[model samples]
Target: MIASRTHGGGRITVDQRADGSGEALQAIIGDVGDLSVQAAVGDFDLATLLTQVPAPLTALNLDACRMRFHRQLAASLLELETTAVGVKAAAFAYRQAEKGISEAFGGLLDAIGYATGRIIAISLPVIIPVAITIGVQVLVVSKILDVTGLDDVITTHFGIDLGKTKEQAKEALVTAVFEHSDVAGAVIEHVLPGIVVGFVGLPPALLDTDADHAYWPHDSQSMTVWLLAGANQFGLLLPSDVEVWEAEGVTPPHEKPPRDLEDLYLREAACHRGTDSGQVRIEEIVGPDGTTRYIVYVPATTDWSAKSGDNTTDMTTNVQGMAGNDTVMREMVRQAIADAGIDPNDEVMLVGYSQGGITAGSLAADPAFLADVNVTALMTVGSPISDFAIGSDIDVLSIEHEQDLVPDLDGNENPAADNWSTITVDYDPDELRKAPALRDKSDAEIADLFDSAGAAHSSTAYAASIALLLRSGNGSLDRFTAKNSGFFTGDLKKTRDYQGRRKHT
Candidate 1:
């Protein structure tokens, strides 16, 4: 006989007899919540209930509709909230990493390119000969053996004598090939190709990628700036120990004639009398846009001996000498800019010739000037400033003649530290000398000689070249030229007042 037992705890029970006969009973009771089910069956009895029911029991309660099927639902909700916060944090980290990577990679590429370019430039010229030598040796040995018939001779003459010495004879034949006359010719022929290959192939292989990316617009601009400096006489050789200009009483005139047309005519007339008389003063020129421009002058040389006890001539000469002192001139320009209450980083243009050109170039290259002023363009004529280094950030244009030895300087290196983007304008000195008829036979007479000479050496030619450089949009130097003529014209007009004032009085 089979007996069945039913328990009311969200489960069913069954009992089987030995004959395999069994009865199944479903347990169902009213109002038995989760606690009643636990009470009806001990907590340890859940395993039996699960086995008997063969169904997942998340919660055993009367209100089965409200019971959750799995705990993962709640866990997933918590994870979703956490993931939102995590994503924001990750995005921020990624941005920082991206910036860091870009900078690192950019720096690395620049260094590798620079080093590789230098190595190729230096080593390519050296490796060609060595490669040729090796190739020549190989070819020469082959050709010598063919021409001298040394292999056959050695095999026939020494193989039998040595008895089992065919290998030795072959070695002898190979050695004899090097001694043949034809070997030299063959070596030369073979080495030529190797030499060509090494000369042409190695550098390309080493620096092809670097060369493509190594150049920049800034490089040209920088070189021009340095070249302009070098072309000007601004290249000052400072003593290791020096005194500041202020301490030395090295200052410009307090009052002077404006460097305008009337002043120029007056100074020019003074030159007729062989009287070295001129005055240059700085003044503020206001533009239509309300921007103020500083205008300085290149005064005619004057005799300072007539001055009173103050020795105004000496002071003028001293000021002229200061044009060669790059450090002093730079400081003065910086002070002038500061005194004008203008930001040094604002756009600045320098136009000067001869001594004035030297002053401008030196001031542009001064680190302090750079820190304070944003030099947009520099134009110098017959200036010897290109001897100095200019910053890569500035634009510098220079006009020089082949005969103008003043523009030429020593130890000019590539990737110039000062004027990296320097462009030199070459002109015919002979042609320049013929442009304007010579009136007087003095050193100053040569000034007009340049007008016809087409010579880069003359001040007139330099001035014309500067005008051309400023007008032409081509070349890195043009980038620094004034964008508008209004400021320049206004400043030029304002300079007339300081043209011919007597500094000695």
Candidate 2:
């Protein structure tokens, strides 16, 4: 017998028998054993996976979210297992062919069998592992999505480009990928793992943001929304409900609505001062055609203590504010309208920032609330109100920042419609400081201007951006502000404040 060394780290002794065929058979067996071991490793690797990808919602008791994360991890492991099976099957097929051919040709086939074994030994092991890795990546994200069932993960869709240039590029890329499905499929197979893990890098709360699915395409902010969130915070900390008494009517029905969005932004900013006392100033405007506009302002999150008893049910948590029934928010709004002595049939236009924006949207969308007061238009900044299904007739205006991330927490923007519109701001501290309102502030002060969602979510920053937008002649903004211009250019109107308390049942 001759001893032959194989790649499997074992030596196989073959009978010489004056035939070279045993050399090939020994080589083939070694390759087969090594392949088998590789397949085994793949099978066992499932247990070793670090399956702790965090969820979008940042709460300790979110069992549902944790389960979904586990499901994705499990699905990935199963894909790995399938790859292992394919490797094992390939090994089995090679071994069987070698056995049958050897039996048929006797020792004469040894040279041919050995050459075949060399090719298999050299090629398949390298090929199989690479192919499996590619396969796992290709299937992992989709597999996770498949098991996601209609749980409210605040998941975002891959479509929708808020930029004209990016939208054009996206169209071209999407068309090409879909046109060549095979190539696109192959590319996706390699990159899907990277896509899934990228969003898991930073939790939004650290930067005072909510979780967003895609950081680049989906996440953004708005100062208007932050201000509203700030208002909510104020209300919670005061532990009081909010009340809004209508502004006194303009003299000749043309004196209000501010000279420009900057004027409007300042007027809105001024509302922030009164939030500490839990009273917000609101404007009730009457137009030439008998249209009425009720301007409402909301602030940020406050009252984060155990004073509220349950975080999930409290108005202080964004999750509760957006997801749960609007007990505190709706009550404050309802009382505001009622205290202002506005009739149920009067048209209401709601505007707010952050949590305040959310509360406004919730009020606009809630049928019960609408039945009592007609919500005609809504304008929000930095608010995640996408889940609120407001009426189509209501004029909706939203502003967001690409890097803000808070607006993305609701998973999507409202569907495109003529009455619905958006303004997206990409905030810059230098640009913001240059604004007249912030010009006098030092760089450090400018840097520290906005707290929650960075400079983009800053009220002063948004005020500057709005001033710029107004100057740019954006049609939607022009129309919204121009129609309400009576507040700034026309007559004297009376503004009032109302007090509110939470209805703790």
Candidate 3:
């Protein structure tokens, strides 16, 4: 329920612990505006009719009555307009104030972080050698004790299991050092390049900046991968026609668009299951007004194998995605959209989870993809996609769980903008306990269960949290939905399910 301080001019706004109101305030304001418009139209019609009546009507003074009515109608209209404007102005001011305070605070924190990072980056050269020397000494001493049988004697008498203790201590120390400092980043940026090229057989040409730029600039992350894995045309690596095919299975028809974000997330969760379910689901919705909009459901990683061969949704694509490379999975999704008969000009909304979320963001930001596909709205769950530069025109709703590690992988916060809103749900064991399937389990058992399922990153947990936020009537959620209402209404035209593979030779 706690809101993160506004960052980058955006606020992660949601109070899950409280059901503040039954109706979203933004919806109420919209209703008020609609009613005002209707009233104004009715008044115009009545006034026109009234003007036709002579001063000496059949009974009363029509002129006086008309004048009185005119004054009353004008007053009413003004009041209604003022109310709507005031409410909107108040909300805007609140957000501006929040942004101002957050920016100031955030800037201070950034300054501190930069200073600390510089210190750590500089210290790494000195620290790494000392640590290695100490580690070798400890290993030698531990081996000597073990060979002399003093390790077991010490464990029996002094209750000191040196070997087990050192392992645990080493693990903790390494974790702490990496997590709290920029040591790993420093090593990757400055120290590891030469070591990797010499010891790991990496080609120097891959790291060359002047190397022909592919679809995306050969940035640091991409260059690192290229150095290690060797350079290849990303576009050639993924051939859509051969790799992607229609899933050969019957899926339940999409009769209607999802009623809310909760329902949308549930659909995303159900999209990918084992080999039978499709990794990509595209639903074409036809509205009553005959306008067509597409909703693309992209599920999380279905294949976890590190070695890529026939599966596009594998670990290799995940790495490519993180490196800002055009991944096979992204290509597969692009083909799925095109194969579904969706035109480049057709309005599209992409909903994704985990790795699927990253692909969605990347597609939204991709200039080549955007040239063909007009993605107007995007919803991502448990994804670290802050690096992607989504168009300002696109509406983005990112739902992240505080406990989920996936969203933090990007190492940057999602930028705040009018078109983008981030919802961060704090971990609550009570919510987990309320689930019928998990109700019988103890708190500890529930924690273990969530950990196994990727904690809050799991689609089920995201859907549940979204349900709560919906029930609570979040303004951010309402605003996002209101802006992209077309994507949530209309009869289902057809649903296309696509299955993708690597198609290695």
Candidate 4:
């Protein structure tokens, strides 16, 4: 007989020698069985009996004994339904506990995943749109500014004072866009969003300005544009008022043409014929107090064949303003300064709009102009001076409005130093309504009619900024000054008093 104990607290007993032997052996078996029964009844303990065994146990024999005992115990347990029922109950409890644990862990993982997803969703919209908008603005400004070409122009012209140097201007622009909250807000709230909304409707009201009377007397130092021609086969050559009056079937007071066709032909001959006869007309206006002023208006003789369209020269001669005649105009300005009683060293204020803006910038670039006439400041509106090289001697303040693409001059050179400031004004629809002159027409109708033939490119809010630049000195005409007086006033819907108030207010 052999016996062994299992880890589950069960004991097994087996009979290995079961032969028909002496009656003594059978009697011994019977005696053992009686002892087992007594043990089961609590008269003896089986564990104490095993410790009391006198024989020595070998390793092999012990292992064989354990195997035989396990087999018998398994058979005995199978025979007892009560033991099987207990085993099944324990297994069921273990499986239920495992299921509970698995479900709890899965819920915790799901919670974590759900929380992570929420964070990503909340941040993505703000981050993606802002990053993309900034990238687009940078690319557009860089392409339009074209600092490389500006640097070349600066190096070619010895005069400084265009604004910040190209590198400095670029850094300043970048810093202004990023570090200045107002600028960023303007871009996000007004510029970029408006662009996304598209130009279908009237521009935002901020850019609109009241149109002043055509003959309004500005300050002595005011900026002005003196148109020299009427409508030609090329297009209307006068100011907006003249064009409007003409459209209404009103006859404008006729004036002598500023230049004769022969003069234009001669000027063109000088360019194409390689002659020095392409002389510009210089006019000196004497004020009532006997103060003499000079104006050098270039004749429309510059070859615009390159820009002429549908591939044919359009009725509008606007492209002529951009041609190589800029050099001739520059020389004419220098000569005009020399002809004036003032010394060439005298500081002068240069002001122009559209073609005149181009002329002013070109004149500022000449070393001769710089030496003979000290340009205290240069102001341009609707001028594409972005393509011209600016000189350090002149401080420039350029004001442009949305949808006015003419002033986005394609050939502006580089700014000299921090002396140049480019301001982009948003257009306002309501302000146009307030303008008594424009009240009869809707903004869309006005924009459509005026914007055609490229007139909108040269149009500005109310010419108040241009007027201020012309009248002021030291380059200190704040944008607020213009905002308060002109088209901006109506667009903002603010009281007239708000003009002088702090911008933050």
Top candidate on TM-score is 3
In terms of lDDT, model 2 sits at 0.53
Name every residue pair that clashes in candidate 3: 310-502
Model 2 per-residue lDDT tens digits across residues 1-505: 1111111111121222212343454555556556655754654464433332343343334545556755765565556555555555556666677667734433222223334434554677787899999999867854664578422242335443324444677656654543343333222222221222233332222322233322321122232233334565654422333333443222123245656667655665554433432334566766565555566654444434524432212344354455434445556667767777778777666777766678788888888888888777777877777767778777777776544555665545455555667666655555655666667888677657843334555566678777666654566676666554544443325455543444344
lDDT of 4 by residue, 1-505 (tens): 1111111101111111112122344455456556545644542356644654654465346546656765665555444434444445555666677668745543343333334444445667787899899999977766664655664465568655344575567755553443333333323222332232222222333122223212221110011111222122344331111010001111111122213212212222222122112223333333344443333333222233322222111212343334323333343445444544445543345555555566676667656556667665565655666545566545566655544545533412224245666655444434433444455777687666443333333332334223323333312234322321221122211110000000110
After TM-score superposition, the amount by which residue 242's alpha carbon in candidate 3 deviates from its true location, in angstroms, is 5.8
Of models 3 and 4, which has the larger TM-score? 3
Query: TM-score per candidate, in order?
Result: 0.34, 0.47, 0.61, 0.31
Q: Pick the candidate with the highest lDDT.
A: 3
Which segments of candidate 1 are over 4 A away from where they belong? 1-283, 295-328, 331-346, 413-430, 433-456, 464-486, 489-505
TM-score of 2: 0.47
What is the per-residue lDDT of model 1 for residues 1-505, given as tens digits with 9 covering 90 to 100? 1111212111211211211221111111122234444554563475756664544554445225323422443455446445544554555566677668845644444344445545554686677788799999978975786689775676688754333464667745543442232332222222222233243333423222322113221122232233333434442221122122221111232244233222322232222123233333344556666666554333322343312222112223323333334333333444545554556544566655544456667677667666767666555544556434566665555544433444432112123233333344545433333332332345566644543322334444544444444344333433323342333444332322222222221
Summarize candidate 3's per-residue lDDT along 91-137 as a digit string, tens digits. 56767787788555544443344444455566778988999999999
Candidate 2's C-alpha runs over 4 A off are 1-256, 273-277, 288-293, 306-317, 450-453, 483-492, 503-505
Candidate 3 Cα misplacement greater than 4 A, ranges: 1-242, 249-251, 273-278, 431-445, 451-454
In Å, residue 301's CA in model 2 sits off its true spot by 3.0
lDDT of each: 0.40, 0.53, 0.68, 0.39
What is the Å distance of residue 343 in model 2 from its true position?
2.2
